[model samples]
Target: MVVDDSPFSRTLLADSLQQEGCEVVGEADSIECLIETYRQCKPDIVTMDIAMPGADGFECSRALLAHDPKAKIILVSSMKDEETEAEARRCGVVGYLQKPVEGEVLKKVIEGVMSPDVLYNNLQSWSIDIFKEALGQSITRMTKTTATFVEAECSEKNISQGITVVIGIIGHYPGSMILDISKESAEKMAEVILRRPAKGQDEVVAMGAEFANVVGGIACSMLNKKDKAFSLRVSPPSVFYGAQTEIASPGIRLHCLYADSDFGRIYLGVGFKKGSVLWM
Candidate 1:
């Protein structure tokens, strides 16, 4: 909930909080209806302004605290007086912010007050980052060559022919990591990792699958370690070859990226049915 005498300021504050993933339950311009509104909404946190019609923020905060001692309130105002801030603290305001607040700062303050939602958001945002870091390191270590990673459009049309390695993920959310590369690229990777010429198509399949496995395993391990809620496990890689093989999953969202290696380009996609759909 947000309480400010100015409707414009209140709306601006509410919009900023919403952008940071905070759900504003209610808004108020006066203290007359604040108590009843608070009781009705039971919001997680309340942001209060110093200048209101009837009573100032401090008085309203004190009154609310008197009613419910556990009420979480944050004083947000242009007024910056040490004595006033001290009085707010004395009344039970958990945080104090000046007139303008940055998005990240607002998020941090809210995170200090309530952490579960922020933690979940952090996990979902980090999902794409896991794969981003994993693939760069996996190829660099295995092939002893640096790769250029860049954001790419993610869609079913991007799925191409040649060597494709599919690795299923189970835990946290059921999804899969798909790796696509040309046969020549697979052979080059296999030969480089093997330190010799890849014998045949069998060697290409084995090496391609192993490469995908390394990426999926490292990425999932990072994700699982991020939080207890994400107990992600990477499945064995399934190798497919040629354009005749078709892959389809109707109800999953995909995030795609490509890395350019010394030998060839490698495309990686992570698909899941749930969690943060838009990657930041």
Candidate 2:
């Protein structure tokens, strides 16, 4: 299956796949149509585009995975930034190919996606310890204070009465990492970073997003160093401020780490895809 907003790109991709001796099962120009088309075609693999009219490929991938946890979806996009690719993985996409992808590369990616060893290798690339180290380093660099890791726990409750900044992780391993801190803590951190009193809610939220970005970037670097095979990328930080902000996705595992600092308590939440087991 091929899903893209552009008819030309869709046709081009389909033709390439066909030339590679793969059957082009179905094509969709939008996310809504793709879901229905997927049901009808039941394709073994789907090549998706990032941009669309209504819902983008990220949202569509999430919907598809919710419907079928084992869906093998690969994103093909011209916007090949680390942020975009990371978000795609968080949406449960199996693979990613940048724009102007070669026919041989696409064929190889499709074949690799079907292999059990490749899937397990991708899953094993994620490390909670690396995540913790990255977060600690980021906090120290930004705030001049070392964050002490207290404990990590699996939780079903939504974050309430605080600001949450989320960064999606992509590439071989797909997941999400969230930095959850109270408004007061956020303001304090913002004040330290800005060298001024943080007054408004917007300022605090922005600081929270920056915190997530810094941590995510460092984490990706550490992960790549450990195993280049992961090809990890991180999405831009997404900020949310309110009481009871739910960050739940069905079939995804959520692991929350509590770290204490002089400023306040910081919660680092890591959400992994269904098949990837969380190693504490």
Model 1 TM-score, all chains together? 0.55
- RMSD (Å) of each candidate, 1 decimal: 14.2, 9.9
Q: Pick the candidate with the highest TM-score.
A: 2
Could you tell me which 10 consecutive residues in candidate 1 have the lowest summed lDDT? Answer: 271-280
Candidate 1 stretches greater than 4 Å from native: 1-121, 245-247, 275-280
Q: What value does the lDDT take at residue 63 in candidate 2?
A: 85
lDDT of 1: 0.79
User: Candidate 2 at residue 234, lDDT?
Assistant: 90
lDDT of 1 by residue, 1-280 (tens): 9999998998899999999988999988888888999999999888889887789998899988888888888888888687876787677777777777776666666665555356445555787789989999999899899999888887566546588899998753578888888899988889899999999989888998988999999998998677534557888888888666555556777778888888888988887655321111
lDDT of each: 0.79, 0.77
Write candidate 2's Cα lDDT for 92-183 as tens digits: 78777888977766876776677746644444445567778888888888889987897666667665458878888875557788888889
